[model samples]
Target: MNSSPPLSNLLRLAAAMIIITLSVYWMIFLRGLLVPILISVLLSILVSPITIQLEEKGLSKIASIILTIVLFLGLIAGIIYFATMQISDMLDVWPDLKRKGTLWFTQLQNWAYRLFGLRPQSQITKLQEMSMAFLSGGGSAALLKTTSTLADVILIPLYMFFMLYYRSFFCEFVYKVMAKSEKQRVNTVLFRICDVVHNYLSGLFIVMVIVGSLNTISLLILDINYAVFFGFFAALLLLIPYIGVLIGSLLPILMAFITKDSPMYGVGVAGAFLFIQFLEGNFITPYIVGSKISINPLVAIIGLLLGGVIWGIAGMMLSLPMIAILKVVFDHSESLKPFGYLIGEPVREESRRVVEEHTAENPELITDEVADSVKEAI
Candidate 1:
């Protein structure tokens, strides 16, 4: 006769939510040391197909793994060297940039004074005072923080090494611990997760290379200084999802503004970035990555914000992948499938019909579905 929800069910839901929130917080805060290693492992899993193919072609597993690691390291090293050289050149011209920036600000102030009859000089003085105050109060601590960040960056490669070495053993152990009935299900979910993450990363890598190369070439044609450095920075930003591209573009534009004393260079840079992003979003990504792990844009943005708040850069990087994994698990579980559907890309009814027809043609495929569905749903 009671119309209210069960107290036991409410308590269980509350407990689950609390646990999830705490786990996320812990991963964001305490797990900073392990983040790079985790990222390496995730990347290794995604690229394992290439390693396995090499092994199948007669190379030893260790040799294939070593080759993969070497290639990754070499690529990273090359980017760093190129970026450093270009940045050094850019820094050599900083005095000129500062002079140009001052001139630009002065012109802006003049324009504002002419149009609005306001004292632009007062605003400039206030800004200078605030900057000086900040430098005196917090700038030393900021320098130490920067140094600590550099130390973390140095540790990433070392973390990567151990993760790559033990990846296979870790995967095997995970599989071994599951009960017989749950083994297949767990394996299926894990494999799908790996596939989604791998495809996503690989597609992103290819896109970044294309985008970076094009940007570099465009800058060269435009006679922009530090073209290589800006190109590489743009490519790095592609790893950050939606906001990364904008941030990436700003750096080169700012550099152009400083070095050339011309707004046209900045305009050109922005235009090129827009074109590239359009191509990537519309054609490249969808075709290469497919709809296998389509996440809602809102969810992705929220995930990114929350990740940034919790784990900083690493959290931002892993946010979407973690969400994708959660979606996969929810899809496979009866009680959670509705939640999965909500997070997933729109499903085509025709595709669903096709899958249903295929399952009908092979009854064995439906055996686990009904049993698992009924048991879990109830």
Candidate 2:
């Protein structure tokens, strides 16, 4: 006999869907307020190791946190200063670049006309019209957006300091909120989350540096202008994951096309970037970053899309870490374990067999402590 789902189950599913929808709406509504806080949380976790080490060396917690924050800010300021200098240099040569680009574009128009019977004047007119339309529509909006972004950036350090200072208080609050029986498991989960975030972030930064160096060397070999700037620019864009490198490649490609005599230089730039991307995905990332987050590709792509919709570029950059954190939380909850697994990498049969063997050897090992140990092994 065929059976329908229970009404209670159906009602529960409906409630979950409704709750998820409302939560997304709430997130979008509070995007500005939430983004900085979320960034602070991640940054705090990432640098907590430094704070801990400083505290171990006899500094007060507050002093350690402040020192860590200062070091972090100094690093960021250095990078920004260098990037700004690069941009200034590029601007200094902007007239030359523009003239060269115009000349190359004329050649492109001639080729287009010869191949497709298109008019160069019509093409130029259409481009001008589109450019004017875009600038006129977006200029004020872009200014406002930039101002808001600066505000958020200023708020991040303050938020991070408070978060790091009050870390114990938050842990205590979580312990107090959960049942005493669940305290040990909750603590384990918290530690796991922190460790995962720290490892993922630190490893990712290393991978970025390696990738950036490779990009710079390739550009230098090709004698590209501002090789360091463009190389690291593309590397920093790795924060946004899959599409970011492509976006970063655009400037270098355009520069090559405009500044070089032949369009083949642009093709060379494109091929170099694509090869770097391939190496990053297959070798560098796997070797350096590893599978600490363990998220499947499908979930990652979907999370990226959803994050972009909610908070634009920052959201996209934060999406994977946020999803990884959510998966950790879900893994610790019995009712939510399936959801965690849904977003995580597929388990192999060999891993499943190993787990089964462990359970068979020690039937009592089906506990939180044992489960986490097994999960770590996998």
**Which of the numbered candidates is closest to the native, going by highest TM-score?**
2
For candidate 1, write residues 313-352 as lDDT tens digits: 7778888888888888887787998877677655432354
Ten residues in sequence with the least summed lDDT for candidate 1: 369-378
Q: Provide the global lDDT of candidate 2 against the true structure.
A: 0.89
lDDT of 2 by residue, 1-378 (tens): 759999999999999899999999999999989999999999999999999999999999999999999999999999999999999999999999999988998899999999999899998899899988998886548888889899988999999999999999999988988866477898889998998889888988998899899889888888889999999999999999799999999989988888888888889989999999999999988776655777878999999999999898889999999998999999778889888878877863246457867887987859867776775666
Error of 1 at 43 (Å): 2.3
In candidate 2, the residue pairs with backbone N, CA or C atoms under 3 Å apart (3 or more residues apart, or in different chains) clash, namely none
Off by over 4 Å in 2: 1-4, 132-140, 347-353, 356-359, 362-377
lDDT of each: 0.76, 0.89
User: Can you list the residue pairs that collide in candidate 1?
Assistant: none
RMSD of each predicted structure: 5.3, 2.8
